[model samples]
Target: MTNLKLTRFAPTPSGFLHLGNVYSFIVTYHLSKKHQAKILLRIDDLDRERVKNRYIEDIFDTLNFLELPYDLGPKNLKDFKSSFSQSERMGQYAKALEILRQSKLLFACDCSRKKVEKMHPKGYYTGFCRNRKLPFDQNETSWRLKADMHQDISFKDLNEGHIVGKLPGILTDFIVRKKDGLPAYQLTSVVDDLYFGVDLVVRGKDLFGSTLAQVFLSEHLGPNAFAQNTFYHHYLLQDPNNQKLSKSAGATSIQFMRKSGKKKEDIYMMIGEWLGVKERIKSLEEFGRYV
Candidate 1:
């Protein structure tokens, strides 16, 4: 055991809970148990355009249906809206943005998606607006970190130990604050983890690049616990075509399965089969053994 204190189930409410989401929950749940760390149900509902009440409701419903429990965070939709909502932490995000601004490591960008694509055929940001000196308060301008592409970022990996890498090309000069003036995921994620004192992070391997990005962003945010936290990037559950399951892929949604008459045991069995575990998995406890 790593003497961990806390971890979280940070789910986004842009779509219904899918099996992939449940798989993440199961891994988080079991890992928390193994390390004697408390679990916090942190819902990422910042994407206002796609967030829906029903999707938020589905998070609680699915957790209850699967009998997955957490040690902290909102117990229901009302509780989340009243206290745990990310929107409530706007001031904290703004504060961090100001710190980054004062560091002179941020620039205002006014490029649109089409414009970015036109600049780089591969769609990667070419730092087009780095020297444009656009005003941060300008309408439709986003704040981007002036990343040091040559600098190495290193962080502790719970499974693989120390990992070192440079910023991925796709995330070059990544946005810290969106054009809407709201903090972007990379910024808010680091702020929220530090806000809640999370020391152990378990997420899918697909976010490996994001992990590196956040670590680099944290360094510029001054001293923060996020950089010291250990991480575990679990393997993802992919489809037959070798594509990772997504919330947008409605067919894999737990809500759809429940509506179609699937039981919790059936859900566990499906996941176990997907993982290729030899023993049948009928409950969360049984699944923990394989985790």
Candidate 2:
């Protein structure tokens, strides 16, 4: 017999919810049930600029629409002291930032969008600010974790099998702290997962590139900071041309689909089909049956 584990569907509020997002939620939602596991709705709203209150409510509504009952979050908490909200836990990010800074692995960057354009036409963060010792331009600065030139990380993704990537090449020493004095996604996300003891992160196939950055962050979080967390990067629903859905694209949005006169059943059915759900599932349990 196997022990039950916890899985979570983390969504950022940078944009409106989409079919790809909803399908991923459904897949992860059912998967946790299949294993008799717990599911957490982690609102990755660290990006304060774009988070909208309506979208936040929409997330709760979508979960209810699917009728998937969750265990922990602002929506529900059963004495799980961590009544959750990433935005409320700003201190965690600060501590993680301090750890990285102490290791001398933190670098302040001053390259603005304008600077990147003027310096390197190709635009992959040409390290103009990488070497700059200029005091962080508080108004126009960002921070990057020093990427190991040879560090490679891999994880056994439940749905996709073994996935691999290198830490340095994809996006060199990427931003951990934004110029606005707030932590960026890569740093706080890993920190929150580690601090919350999240061991199963079931998310979109798109974040596979994050393998390097996150694994590296986890590995360096002061030793044994996090347990072995498994990931499931499920197949994403793409367009006819196979371009993965982006928030910027309207076709991916459930709200858009809803506005297009898509019945909620029709929307769920389309999402279910996209996720390879074989039969019509009226509830989360029925959804779990297909998985």
Candidate 3:
């Protein structure tokens, strides 16, 4: 069957695929199945230091146990695309850098983490390197994309409906590459989606704020950079204590559930109940029908 929609279950195999991951995964699976979409499982093993074999295995194991079939990926480091890791996509990031440079939006600075911590700014990016193009040296220096003053990009979110926020100084001067010769998440993610021709993104609301960063970068991207081709569906996130679950929070671990001999039904049911669709998910086939 030629599935009209294309969705991905991209996860970073850095740590155990936890309850938060499962909730998002199953929701994306439901959306994909509803649209008869081709689901690709891309491993976001960007953090090389943390990406391990066991974690990767657990990702597949969890999906397999839940009967969530994927058409591509779940690939290991060796079986992946040459530059599978986001850190390895330097060339692609460099190309993006050149584009931002041509637009006179590229700048450099040698601000340390300590400096930023001492005087934390409202935005994650402190705008230290927004215009301080001192020099590009391997020994030190980071680059940021110049964000225009009081700029804002408005869009309608599928789930959240209308979202109008000021990205003014927030997005001004973001990083495309890091000092360790690694690409930042925003730059790499945008580049990958554009290059891979991803048409739809079904993810948890956790990534909603991330969409803001992507939208800003998209404004400066070239025509047909694949920026305008995608659609996003940010579903409800799983919150254990009216707060987002974290690794430190014992309830967040899926490994803990598995060890406790939790069945597929247990996990699926929890997801359905939380989404308030428990009555609809009578069976695996019933998921798409109801959603």
Candidate 4:
């Protein structure tokens, strides 16, 4: 494999950082070092309703406490707010949206969650709005890409080599710009990755569908570098009930664990046990060996 130039830990400050977040960070750190790539700490703070100042502070606090370092991005909350926040890149997102609009590949929809659930049992968008001809500037309307399910989407995978697949049903015609006038996650993520020159992406396997969605979006944005980037989707850390850990599960958050007197080593040990690593992991270096 060719040496990658950069990778990133793109965390959203919607809630406190959890053990699962740290596991993905460790994997990114390991791969960055392995490929001699610089790490960029990209904080996704676009969801204004869920984003809180305390949650943003927790990101910097957790990284400092764990001694995880990044070569690029804001050094603290103040720096992030001043420059690195996703809001700072609204213009770039707008440009990409315009490109899609000009390509005639975007449609405006004003469907509510309840209405969508009623349309299909699985709640998958039935492309009801594809021919609705809703105005792009209409209030309470979101812009969605008109997806071609039969089209093959291909991208490089760090572990399994080049892989190809069709866009998943759940992500069919995924929203690019939300009703609230902000670019959605799928749109912002591709723009940011391309903007920051991130050639290596590390995320959880749960996001494999998202990866495909972003790759498909990249193709529509004209010739771009996002599709060429390599991805690594690591296994998730689940609770005893085999449920995926979420920020809403406060007890599993690093902040909660820290308050409970769990040191960084304790957190690492817990993750090691969950990962089924035979060797005890007491530090980032030890954990690196296993990842």
- Per lDDT, the best of the predicted structures is 4
- The TM-score measured for candidate 4 stands at 0.98
TM-score of each: 0.98, 0.84, 0.83, 0.98
Q: What pairs collide in candidate 4?
A: none
Question: Which whole-number lDDT from 0 to 100 does residue 71 have in model 1?
Answer: 94
Go through the candidates in order and give the C-alpha RMSD of each one to the true structure. 1.0, 3.6, 3.4, 0.9
Comparing candidate 1 with candidate 3, which one achieves the higher TM-score?
A: 1
Backbone clash tally (model 3):
2
Rank order (by lDDT, best first): 4, 1, 2, 3
TM-score, cand. 3 vs. native:
0.83
For residue 49, model 3's alpha carbon misses the true position, in angstroms, by 3.4
Worst 10 residues of 4 by lDDT: 282-291
State each model's CA lDDT, in order. Answer: 0.91, 0.70, 0.65, 0.93
Model 4 ranges off by over 4 Å: none
